[model samples]
Target: MKRYLQYGFTTFADHYGSSEILYGQFRKGLLASAMPTTPRPIGATKWCVFRSPPTPYSRKYVEEAVRERMSRTLSDGIDILQFHWQDYDDPRYMDVIQHLLDIKRDGKLRIDELGLVNFDSRRVDEICRTFGSGALVTNQVQFSLVDTRPLYGMASVCAKHQIKLVTYGTLCGGFLADKWLNKPQPDPYFDSLTPSQRKYLDVILGAWGGWELFQTLLSVLRAIGDRHNGLSISNVAVRWVLDHQFVAAVIVGARLGVAEHKDDNAHVFGLRLSQQDRVDVASVLADRTDKI
Candidate 1:
């Protein structure tokens, strides 16, 4: 997987146990807003970064932050720099984004693309209108079959602005995969689930229907996988997201040096869903997206 292909090397939004992975909840103040960006590990393949800068927003601060991130990349410059900002009430995030875009325009550090991380539909629209079209390239957000919030309204905003969605959680932290199919819901109070699992379980119960509905969804995905040359549920899920025209890419999470699904992940491109496949998945997803 390392030796070939056009895919960019991606990383997790946060270390699995960290609360920052709860990207959508910052508006409610559910998690810390501005933790230090996770350092890119030595020898890591880095294409994009997820960073949230705390205010007082200034050009010096933004430049220094962008420089620090670029210095960590293996090349002289980074391919994609994705910005995350909490405190939507502040309104100075526009200044910060402007500064980053200025740096990219300067071309000294070679920031090939600029994007937003976890900004919602309304914010995306506002930013795009403020910056005018084509100023930024993408927005990274959580979009899995189990959590269709992005599809609810995010997709339309991206289409209108000509921005692509670089999505994470397409696997729902791996719950949407086959290993969890037919499995009973784990008790969060017990050790049956990791912190990430516990986090996504909240999404599963809230944004999706409850456990039984999730199981039914999983069964549908498994059957869909079978229809496409016995592809795994993971492949089926990735395929579903890629099938969306507004989705520029899907960011699958993995722990570096521990495990990687490069081979299985690549198979997603080989499978294509039929019209019936979409209906079956949609049947289980019926009315669940209303909460999102």
Candidate 2:
């Protein structure tokens, strides 16, 4: 089995844009949002994430942030800079690209190290045509056994252009483990009240055809885990994502110093889910994505 430190290069998202609200959440301070603009002097791959466009601010506000952040890249000689692009149709999309290119052209950002968040196959070709070859490195999205939307088509688009996938939501907010097996449904208000927490359970129960079927799928995963020498349900689920065609990395969130399942997460590096494993697990899932 691969060691946890072997996958230690996964990107960490510090508090949103270095805000005090986020910084206060941690006892030990994390890397700043502008850290992406600074490369590791010893050749380590550096990553940083921003929560959203600094809003309630004007275009000048946005431009100043970009310029200020990008300037650090020039001073520090960084290569790749990462950010999210939620809406491709947004007019600001063009401006964002132009700023990155300007940074690259001026030797602040490396041309080969641009990445965007939340894009899937439908947008891959458009991204390529707009950014050109080797301009982008990753198309980060949600991909897991419980969420295989990428497998339906996104994999092919990414594979064609050599774009790597960075996936998240692999553990489904701790629901993909033994703790939930045969458990009573969580209260929508008192148990799973957070919007995301509720929505994912809905996706799982709905996809598996109902809460009853989801339990069955969990049982199947448990059996598979036992057969594989006490492999974890979390491992099986994340390994399934890695087994997909174009995934490069999976982001498993860490709550600092609370190293609970970091060991199981490392198992993903070496485990391979068998064909029967895939069929058994995917069988109960609904392809209800057509509504969108």
Candidate 3:
């Protein structure tokens, strides 16, 4: 999906040469004329798309904002649009979504589906109930062993409304990998961790019971991986998220040429946690008191 959307081809001049289905597109003009040499392949998937427009209280501005995005997305042959709103207390999200529904109803836009990102359970339920189940397709959120807050309330709402979860942060910003397994915790003031690393590290130390407990969790994951033909801890971490029935997909961040995990990632499909593996992981998790 990244290759086709970003470069307009399935394979680019990169070290990792593998082919996968293009299921979704996140940005507009990713296939625009800037890279005209690579036209979209014939019969490429009309992506389930995502965009974030500034929140506006007026229904008129909301419609205008979405329409502008729709024009760009349609130009790229996309049919679905997902939204991200930060302040739910604004109460204008419903109006914006309602405008989107009206545009779809009026046949003014080509959006075949609408979805949400970072929306809580209550709002998701209200939207589905207000617009009907068919109105929204999925809700994107952070879900992983380290961040299981969704399981408490969001998962139940999704299961009840049949809204699929598109999860991100499953790898805890790359901290759930072999590189950090037995390493000492970094000094936040001096370490050169990326913004993503620093953010998830806080989750690990603050929400996930600090470095000692995190090390214990990593040990259990490593042991589990050893039984599965020396799979990496990252693979096991991702598979744990996929093991959930409510998860439609796990979003792993990629740095096109800088780094690639395509080879190790394929192993996730083949590695399934045994009943004993689940038990061991659960044992470690049971000690955590943080909801996130």
lDDT of 3 by residue, 128-221 (tens): 9888877887787889889998889988888888888878889988889988888999877799888988998888889788888889889999
> Model 2 TM-score?
0.73
- Top TM-score model: 1
For model 2, residues 75-190, the per-residue Cα lDDT tens digits are 23333455565655554655665566666677643444666677657666776777775667777777766677787777777877788887878777777778888888787678
Clashing pairs in 1: none
Q: After superposition, how far is residue 56 of candidate 2 from its true place, in Å?
A: 16
Worst 10 residues of 3 by lDDT: 13-22
TM-score of 3: 0.79
How many clashes show up per model?
0, 0, 0
TM-score of each: 0.81, 0.73, 0.79
Off by over 4 Å in 2: 1-10, 14-80, 109-112, 192-195, 286-292
Judged by lDDT relative to the true structure, which candidate is superior, 1 or 2? 1
In angstroms, give how far residue 94 of model 1 lies from its true place: 0.7
- Summarize candidate 1's per-residue lDDT along 1-292 as a digit string, tens digits: 2211224333323322332222223212322333244223111122232444454767787777666554443245556677777778777778888888888898866777788888989999999999888998889888888777787898899889999988888887778888889988877897577677888998887766788888888889899988888889889888888899999888777764465777788787668789999998878777574455
